[model samples]
Target: MTDVFFYHLQSRPLEAALPQLLEKCLERGWRCAVQSGAPERIEALDQLLWTYDEAAFLPHGTDRQPDPARQPILLTTAESNQNGAAVRFLIDGAAIPDPSAYTRVIHLFDGNDSEALERAREAWRAARAGGHEVAYWQQGADGRWVRR
Candidate 1:
């Protein structure tokens, strides 16, 4: 069964948090695909992964780039898993695909956005109904994730 995790972003913006998650994925030797609801968000994330850290490198490429299948981390607005990723990250209210296709499915939503919260609720129900293992993590006051 796929393990589904919901990350409610409260203390930090997605830009500040995503790179760290992607780094952890890479550390686990998991190829990852980050799917966004809009092309503009994908474009923004593409640039973010490059300059988020001055010393650390998070190797990634957008789906528009050549050889997407070879990238460790792939960013896109599409549903297709071009990189054969072991984990998939859905952001910006992106639609959830079949969760069983990957080892893990992560949904990152803005806590401040009502629509995003509703979408996350819908996703939680869907994931539970689909028989996938589901967990919710909310940011604590200090900005660390606390599973709830």
Candidate 2:
């Protein structure tokens, strides 16, 4: 069973939190696929990952690239895991119809959005019942992530 992580964002927005997680994924030599509920959010996330930091960089792209497998981070609105990513991030209420293909699934939901929070709750229950290892992470007062 795939390891499922639920990140409850209490302070920073997804824009500020995701890159940090992606950076950690890179450090662990794991490729990542970030999925959004809409194509517009995927496109926006693509640009944000590129320019979020002036000095740092996260090499990533969508299917529009020449080679998807070469991307350390792949962003998309679809549920396909074509990039061979070891980690899959479901952002902005995105859901994976088939998650067995992934080693891990990260669910990052906005705490302010009641619908998103509810969706996350349902997902956690379903995944846990499916015998997957589940964990919940929340941003601490110092803006650091503490798995709760």
Candidate 3:
């Protein structure tokens, strides 16, 4: 069963939260693929992962890489998991068609956006109905993820 996670972003933007989550996945020795609904979002995400921090370096690539398997992290608008990622992240209101294919699937949404919040709820219900373990996390006052 795929462990489904919903991250409600309130205190910080995607740029602040995404890297932290990706870092944790990397520490767990898991390859991750971040999928966005729009191509521009994918392109923006690729740049964010690289320049988000000065000291930190997240080795990632989009379709420009000669080999997808070699990338530790991948940012793409495609639904296909070309990197064989252990974890899949759906960002910017993106939805995964088949969640069970990955070890974990994360649905991240901006809490401030009503549409995003609605999408997260729908995703949670769908995953639960599918018999997958679901977890909900929201940002605390200090911008840390607190399970709710």
Candidate 4:
């Protein structure tokens, strides 16, 4: 069974936590499949993948190598109606189809953006309905995201 780890937060990019998460997965001999199509997410992951590729941190096996064409961050959307994956990190109204396919879901929300807030709520509802483990992270006024 695939295990899902979610990092939901307010106002902070999920990419900030990705390096640490990927490192942890590598430590455990697990390769994570990031599912996102956001340009920012892709760009960040690309750097990490390169770091791993160049042996800056550690040697990366095929499992750790991110697919360039089909970035692990964004899965194929041919099967869904949503233009992008269902993620509410920086936007609103993104839907994740077949939540069961994901072992975990991370919901990040910023109290500042109404769209983000709506996406967060929707993600919570969808995750609950799909019986998936979802994590929430919210940004505090001090400018840090704490798991809520």
Candidate 5:
């Protein structure tokens, strides 16, 4: 099954959910990845995941970049239009790298409009309809990751 995560960026800190989510993905032998524009949060997540899972945190891209020998999960930070690669991978419905390649796609958004959220949900559903497993998570009021 393709696992997906959606983290909502709100007034609360959404970064807090990364480590635990990564750990869960690792325990299940699922390839995991995270994308965010928040540098500090991404860095913190990386540190925690690596500290606990030791090589479970990986960095990913659309191009051919080898996974760090140390980590199996991919961590990507959005910059300029660079974040489009991640979005393209999802929107174009191309295959992502493993375990990320396996289908569990997580999308993080800054929650404000329900219509936007609905569109995202639909996109995710399309991915699933194409025969991929998917899941979602978002920043809760308390700043923790919660399923949508």
Candidate 6:
């Protein structure tokens, strides 16, 4: 069963939080695919991953790039797992793909946006209905994830 994680972004924006999570994924030797609802968001993420930290480099490429399957992290707007990623991150209200396609599926949403919140809820229900193991994490006062 796929482990589905719902991250409620309240204390910080996705830009601040995503790199850290992706870093953890890399540390675990997992390849990742980050899917966004908009192509513009994917473009933004492509830049963000490259320069999020001056000392750290998260090797990634977008679907538009050549040899997307060779990328450690592929940023895309499509639902297909082009990189053969073990983990898939759905951000910016991206539609959830089949849970079984990856080992883990992460859904991150803006807590401040009502529409985003509703979408997250729907995704949560869908994940549960699909019999995937679901977990919810919300940022605590210190900007740390506390599974809820």
Question: How well does each candidate superpose onto the true structure, as a TM-score?
Answer: 0.98, 0.95, 0.96, 0.54, 0.47, 0.97
Better of 1 and 5 by TM-score: 1
Tens-digit lDDT string for candidate 4 (2-26): 2223344444554445545555544
lDDT minimum window of 10 residues, candidate 4: 81-90
Give each model's clash number.
Answer: 0, 0, 0, 17, 18, 0
Q: Using alpha carbons, what is the TM-score of model 2?
A: 0.95
Q: Relative to the unseen true structure, what is the C-alpha lDDT of residue 52 in candidate 2, on a scale of 0 to 100?
A: 96
For model 5, how does the per-residue alpha-carbon lDDT over 1-148 read when each residue is reduced to its tens digit? 4555445556553344455655565667655445554455556655665465554543432212453323345555532223222221121112233323344565555467575467566666666676665666666567666666
Task: List lDDT for all candidates, in order.
Answer: 0.94, 0.90, 0.91, 0.45, 0.48, 0.93
Q: For this target, which candidate reaches the highest lDDT against the unseen true structure?
A: 1
For candidate 1, lDDT tens digit of each residue in 1-148? Answer: 9999999999999998899899999999999999997999999999889999899999999999999999999998889989999999999888756999999999999999999999999999999999999999988988888999
Candidate 3 similarity to native, TM-score: 0.96
Those runs of model 4 whose alpha carbons end farther than 4 Å from true positions after fitting are: 1-6, 10-12, 39-41, 48-95, 108-111, 139-147
Q: Candidate 3 residues 18-111, lDDT tens each? A: 9999999999999999998798888888889889999998889985568877788998787889999999999988877899999999998999
| Residue 42 displacement (Å), model 5 | 5.5
Kindly report which residue stretches of model 1 are placed more than 4 angstroms away from their true locations once superposed.
Answer: none
Please give the range of 10 consecutive residues that has the lowest summed lDDT in model 6.
92-101
C-alpha RMSD for every candidate = 0.7, 1.1, 1.0, 6.7, 7.6, 0.8
Candidate ranking (TM-score, best to worst): 1, 6, 3, 2, 4, 5
Candidate 4's TM-score: 0.54
Cα lDDT tens digits for candidate 2, 5-119: 9999988999999999999999899999998878888888888988999988899998666887788899987788878999999998889986777888999999889999999
Q: After aligning candidate 4 to the native by TM-score, how far in Å is the CA of 84 from where it should be? A: 20
